[model samples]
Target: MFKNAVQLFEIFGFKLRVDPSWLLIAALIVWSLSTSYFPEAVPGETRTLYTVLGIIAMLGMFLSLILHELSHSLVARSYGLKVGGITLFIFGGVAELEEEPHDPKSEFRIAVAGPLMSLFLAALFYGLTRLAADGTEIGLTGAVFGYLALINLVLAVFNLIPAFPLDGGRMLRAVIWQMTRDLLRATRISSRIGSAFGLFLMLTGAFAMFSGGGIGGFWQILIGFFILNASNGSYQNLLIKSALRGKTAQNLMSSRVHTIDPGASIAELVDDVMLRQGVSFVPVVSGERLLGYVDTAGAQSIDRSEWGMRRVADILVPASPENTAAPATPLDQVFKRIGLMPRRKLMIVEGQRLVGVISLSDLVHHLALEQEIGTSLRG
Candidate 1:
């Protein structure tokens, strides 16, 4: 979901990525700590000392955030959920789960894992702070540890706030889901509450700004907007998931696929397939086996004069997970894949044999038809 994010490293088979926006937040944290927090907490420290301490503290906070998100990923994996990766963004971090929990209990466990991990880290840092402190002298080490302790406590408490997409909001949704046995209803109620809470925060922030609360007020407003957007997006995603439930790629793909031979010239592909049929992409096959695909872009990449000389195999975009899905793949998963792809399409395959092609337009048409016909796709 994040663009231009840098992959930091991999831990326990989970990739860790940091978005560029996070760099801005990280700099703000360092500056705030060096100028205000550290100087105040450790009096008489030099500017250089304070800066060094701030940098260390920032690094510690980064590790703490990773651990918090890692906890969530680990728990979800235990329940057989596929975690795409952990991404650190402007707000904090998120463990991207490929699919929702199968049941409320799994959901509750997954949602609560982060806060619980944060709480543990808070206790751990508090203990370290106590150990580093002298009887009457709280040195730089003690101060840094104390700050980490408090921040971890804050993170735990902040994430526990009942707002949709937040740990607490998700926990609330899980409880409601268990009680009512309706995941959709639970999500709708929690997301509405989350949106209301976001509105309240924005208003409070506006009041703070007018009352001279300064940058803090602006920060709160930004966070409020993020939460509001995320809440609505989460609800919409659930609706799509509900609509596609029990459906597979086979049900959504267009079986009337137009395939091209590997030896077909780019000129033939452009004129015969693309212009005549108005199709942008055509899969290249050797008998029944899928080799890859050639699109209008690939054909155009070659000069028009050389179109007749270049073959489809020479300009083929190799088939991979990004542009292909199994016939049995869930429609929701296919939908997500298509959204992420530049082509906005996927080839449905059975083993190495191409079965059909599914595009974003096809999925949209299916959803629109369902709504128009008032069809209930629920099992």
Candidate 2:
């Protein structure tokens, strides 16, 4: 979901990234704390002092979020799953686990880790607050910590609510999976519950808005909409992955891909390949060696006037192993790559030779056909 995220730090072998959307939430927290939260709680303090405290509270919140996500990542890694780093966005943070948990036990551990970490932090903060003296500078710090402890405790409890894609939802799914030994069935059940919860949230938010809740209601509605959409998407993607299970790039890839000469100019590519051949992408090759892949989208980056001046190599996306998948690679893995890809395609390679190409369109078409066939059989 994070298109332009900046890597903030590398923690315990996992990269932590801050998405642009995080700034929105961060600003909201800072504003809410500075103007209302801190001012009301710690009266008689200067505006500057309140602002500083707000910032400090904000930082504490950020740390808590990181620890929560890190807990998930660390647990998943301990189970031998690939940790694709964490991204902090408007909805807080998510650890990008490359693959689903192998079993219900693993899933249960991973799902519960974040909330447990939050609860632990809450306890630690509460203990700190208890140790501090009252009516002093240290007491004010303790009060801030106490507030943080409360928020963290709330976070833990809120996350334990069984909603799909959320920690609680995953826990629900794990429990169901353990009972039935059917991951897909468990996912469907949890997702439906999540959708229901999302609808409830939306309705409650609407009612709150009509009753003068204003921004809080609006925020609830936004979160509800996000959860609803994400839950639906999660289920759909699960179905797609299940259908594509045991399938490989060779199952869906197109062998007859048009190749572009590295020496050819962008104008030539547009005229000959795009306009005539009706192909959006062409592999830029020097003999049998795969150099890169060029598309009309990349060509648009340069001025149309410069099309004749620049070579296809200048506009091509570099052929990295990361962008190329083996013919034997699972379709699910290919789908994951396409999600993160700028070009929205993968080159099917056998050793150093490009055997075929798999685009986003190909995978979607394949999945659609599979779904249709399954429906027909069921009917």
Candidate 3:
């Protein structure tokens, strides 16, 4: 994945964000093809021609991955989802959407669209391969075309595996959602399959390693690791979806919290902490309106000696409730938006004056309560 991919870039207005890691992967692919697939020692073939063909093929393959992701984005957009555009990474690509699909039919279309595009590409390459094979002078063209055709065919078939984080897994989720009419159940089942698939890949890779099967085994293990992380995310997302459904910021927020002004120093904050208003995190407010927030955690990031010297305005994170959200933001989303951020509490702003704070503890408690209620209902 990218360290931090840019949101957009103008490439004919169809923005492309290249993941940082994608650059490395693409370079490695190019090198592999240039040296391994194209060689000067081959009889009756020029190294330059093979090199050029290798570059072209690799470029085309990258573009193909982009198109696959674009297909997902466009379909989701047509269904009124907010798309954050497609990103190319080590595993290929992903079209980031703001929320999970609300309708099974919409989910089906979005999931199917990617592999369908790959199949179309496979056909195109196959036709080119056929045409080149008939032409005597274009042996290199035929080989490259043939490779593309076969690669795309592999892509299409591989993605059909019913496991989490794969297109096939997503398709399975859509089908299950349609059949059971339960999104959580569908996600749980599909992701569990994905995790199982990951374990299979890992085990195979380990066997291959001991058997001296070489780099292919290494790739399998790496892919298995990717699957493990991705499926875990999907499972965590299920919990978030559930958390979002039953609660709001108001439901989780602790009311009548203390406040901080822009002019206040960390020294002032440290003094407030001493009062133990039962507050680990405090809201930063100005006038009767809201600004952002300053957590004791953020203050801790600075040198304690500098605490008296630093103003809250210099360190406090300002947030607009419109841009920021109540704990009501899907719990998965809240964690994602505030990744590894200090103090999980998101300030709940109404008209400001520091109304309340919603901490992770609050969301966790609410989720536990909801589970208990559901259990009781079943009983």
Candidate 4:
């Protein structure tokens, strides 16, 4: 989702990235705090002093967000789930988990970790605010701490609202899932609540805007739309995963795959195989043994004149987990790997032999057929 995110740093093996949209939000936060919040909180502060305090407060909020997401990542890892990373976007930060929790208990714990951490930070900052108020001469330091404390408290409370995809929503899902023993049904119920909540926020924002709330109302509307979209997307993704649960690479792969001899010259590959067969990717095999694979990108990298001198071996990408999967590998795993590939293809290999290949188009076709036949793949 964060295609344009910039990596900041890693903590406890979790990489933190900031999306480009975050810069806009960061600027707004600084502007709001400097011009309005800090000035009102500390009445005698100069404009410059307020701006400085605003920047400091914004930085503190940034840290607070990271710590909140980090708590989720740490707990998810403890449950043996793979975390892709944490990304800060316009809305806020997210701990991207590669897979869902195996059980409702694990999901509950993972979802609750973030808000709990926020609450802890809120208490800690409140205590610091009191200390700073007693010792500081200008009271600026205390004001900043006070703001952070209040914001964190707000964060904790807002997330505790039972809306799907939110911490509270997930907690609600966990409770329902435990009672009903049906995850999909629980998700459906929670997501519907989330969507309703999002709609309510949108209507509330619209009313506030007409009532002269201005920018604040606009922001509420924007956040409401984001929540509405995210809740629906999360449910759809679960449905797709459910449909693919029992499938494997062998079930979806095309056995009649095109292969090129590694000894073949790059010129022959580009002319005879790529152009004639209209195939962009072909496995480089030597007597049924898979070596690597070559694609249009690899072929285009060489100068036209040098194509005659180079062999397929020279341009082939070495077989690796990124490009190849075992035939018995689960389809969901293959689906994830295929999405990462530029060509959206994966060679199904058995030991050193190339058995078949799978592509995104193949998966789409299969799903389409299942839908056409009125198969109820969803759990």
Query: What's the residue-level lDDT of 136 in candidate 4?
Result: 48
Q: Which has the better lDDT: candidate 2, or candidate 4?
A: 4
Consecutive 10-residue window with the lowest summed lDDT within model 2: 131-140
Kindly list the per-residue Cα lDDT of model 4 for residues 30-146, writing each as its tens digit: 999999988887888689998888889999999999999998999999999999999999988999999888889998999999999999999999998898885444288888999
Instruction: Give a tens-digit lDDT track for model 1, residues 13-109.
Output: 9999999999999999999999999888889979999999999999999999999999999999999999999999999999999888999999999
lDDT per residue for candidate 3 within 133-207, as digits (tens), equals 754543677777776887788888888888888999999999999999988878888998999999899899989
TM-score of each: 0.81, 0.81, 0.81, 0.81
After TM-score superposition, what is the CA distance of residue 316 in candidate 1 from its true location, in Å?
6.9
Residue pairs in clash, model 2 = none
Name the runs in model 3 displaced over 4 angstroms. 1-3, 6-14, 39-43, 134-138, 259-343, 364-379
Residue 79 displacement in candidate 4 (angstroms): 2.8
On a 0 to 100 scale, what is the lDDT of residue 10 in model 1?
99
Where does model 1 exceed 4 Å of error? 127-137, 257-326, 340-342, 347-355, 369-379
Error of 1 at 252 (Å): 1.9
